[model samples]
Target: MTDEVAEDDYEEVVENVALCSECDDYMEHEILKERKVGTGRDLLLKCISCSAINNLQIREPKSISIPFILTDGPHSARVELAIDEDEVFNIGDVFEEDEMLWTINQILDKDKRKKKTILAIDASSISALRTDMVRVKITATRGEQSDSSSMLVEYGTKFTADTKIDYQGEVWRIRAIHTGAGRTLKGTVESQDIKRIYLHEPPNPEHFEPKTPRERRQAWKEGRLGYNPNPEIPKEITKKRVTPSNKRKKKRPRK
Candidate 1:
């Protein structure tokens, strides 16, 4: 009788271990145990309802730092810094200590040492002919030889249609329309050394008049001036006459 009682107690313990704690109901549960040779034993509890396993080991968080430098230049300024592959740095932060800062300053100073070239225009002569064609001669000098070019200007207009000019060794095409009072030249640099200049006329509102809506419609209809009527056709059906020889031939074939 005592052996039976001990067996009953053992069975009860096994049944309790197999029951799932999350569901509050009796269900099959798996026991997972991990033990390392150097580390202590670790036991993980897995819930069947959530399907989640608890991590037993605690891990430390890792972080990194980066350094940078900011320097000013003649044309523009920049920030230089040294950063690790894992490090992050914000803008305007200096990290290269003082060495990179001095290097950047020196580069900026050297760039500022460059001298800018100055360009000067000699003179421009405008000539008008009886044929209504106008010519403009322009001479410009930049350091050495004076480059000269000519453009044709139209009369009664402030801007020219198209004109090409060569300055230095490059050619420029004119694509601008000048509309300023007294300065009525439209020009653009066609190439590195050439400029194309043209003349433009001011807006003339008096030259155009708005037409009435009725007049516009009338004009549209009048544009199709010529019309032709289609010929009429009769709808009556016509019957064809049958020849006796043909009818006999058809009957003979059937026979």
Candidate 2:
């Protein structure tokens, strides 16, 4: 009797690395979250050293596995790797001897496997609702107006009009929210600002220009404006007409 080995006996491992700005060294980064965006995977990695945030994109590879059968070899066996009617195989991807080492080299239908755009929503909204700070996957997009932003969350996300969230290093208060019957919900937030700069008209540089002699003197004294005491004219290059290439050419056909 001979012993047999199965394909499920081995484990696969993948390593992800990132650089820490504070530590200035490459460190093993822990993946906080992964979102499918287009044809790649958007990964949020946290530096193990200083806990800094880093973004990484991982694209799909061309390798695809298909089944193959060993017929001419010493052992004629029936396996799942045998070519099926719907499967497509590439050259150099199949081996007659070892089934475990066979590597797929061709790409299948890439468009079908592609995912839609995924937005990284601010996780601080959960904390602002007075809930425990835990990792949550939410889909969101940018707001239409400046100084204000909106986010899309899954249905049943606990929040109210008074909810506060930290987005892009700034704290904002939720102003309005619209919940849908579907699994998605939209929410808007505005900056918690006390005052805003309102202008009647855009300031013109020429209008603010110091036209009067006293204004110009005051400007000079205050170091608000200055001009070059001595300016140097740039030297221009004069192009010289040279003869065309003297290389011989093939004879033209007679008209």
Candidate 3:
């Protein structure tokens, strides 16, 4: 009797939950009754949400079984998924379905089997520079042979005047720093000599220009281009046949 009670205490039904066909959510069910017909047992359950009745059959004792009460002890626990970077998993993507489901299950298990609907998800990465470390936004302008470009740079509090740093595959040294509004500092940087700087760093090349129209057409005909969708118009034209029209009977002028 003691062994039977211990077995009952640890008895858990790990059944694959079925979602509602109407609402597409897990249904809360309670076993209405069970009847033994011949050698098989039939269990009837009614969903609390939709009030829909579902019948389950039990042929073998160990095949599959669901508990009368779907949830165990308490279902109040909440689960949270915090991402420290950009979105790594998309829910609707087929390739990431397994990974997303695995991550969700891990969170649910850790939070005492909480429902997945209440799970909180955060996708933004934590900022490295805090409110105190932020110095000021400075306008950074770089001059090229033909044109000049400018961008707003965020200078941290740790950086000072005459400090060297790398930006956009080029070496730039800070020229000057001035006190700005609200405990901030504005800085300027200038380009240095084009010496052999970085190890294994490839040189930046000019923007690519597409070939001429005649060259592109030749490349397309030789199949050097990417995927081309051809409906095989020539083959289809051979299969098409013009149907003969029936001639109408001409009535006589006297009639």
In terms of TM-score, the best-performing candidate is 2
- True-vs-predicted CA distance for residue 150, candidate 3, Å: 10
Ranking by TM-score: 2, 3, 1
lDDT, candidate 1, 1-255, per-residue tens: 999988878844332133345566555444466545343444455655554454343232233221212322112333333323333222222233333322211111122331122111110111111223334444444345546556544434333335543433555433343332223244432221223233223335554433777655443444422342432222231123433454543445655
What is the Cα-based lDDT of residue 101 in candidate 3?
Answer: 17
- Measured with C-alpha atoms, the lDDT of residue 248 in candidate 3 is 78
Off by over 4 Å in 2: 1-24, 30-33, 38-40, 64-94, 97-255
- Winner by lDDT: 2
Predicted structure 1: lDDT: 0.35
**Against the true structure, what is every candidate's RMSD?**
28.5, 33.8, 30.2
Clashes of 3: 0
Q: What is the C-alpha local distance difference test score of each model?
A: 0.35, 0.42, 0.39
Model 3's alpha-carbon lDDT is 0.39
Clash statistics: count for each candidate: 22, 2, 0
Check candidate 2 and list the clashing pairs: 67-81, 68-81
Weakest lDDT window of 10 consecutive positions for candidate 1: 118-127
Model 3 regions lying over 4 Å from their true place:
1-135, 144-157, 181-255
Across residues 1-255, which tens digit of lDDT does each residue of candidate 2 receive? Answer: 123344465555536766767678887789999999788899999987789998888875443233223332123343443232333333334333342333222222333231222111201000011011112322223353344223333323455443555544545554444333222123432221111211112234698889999888766655556764443232331123444478689899999
Positional deviation of 26 in candidate 2, in angstroms?
Answer: 3.9
Which residue pairs show collisions in model 3? none
Q: lDDT-based ranking, best first? A: 2, 3, 1
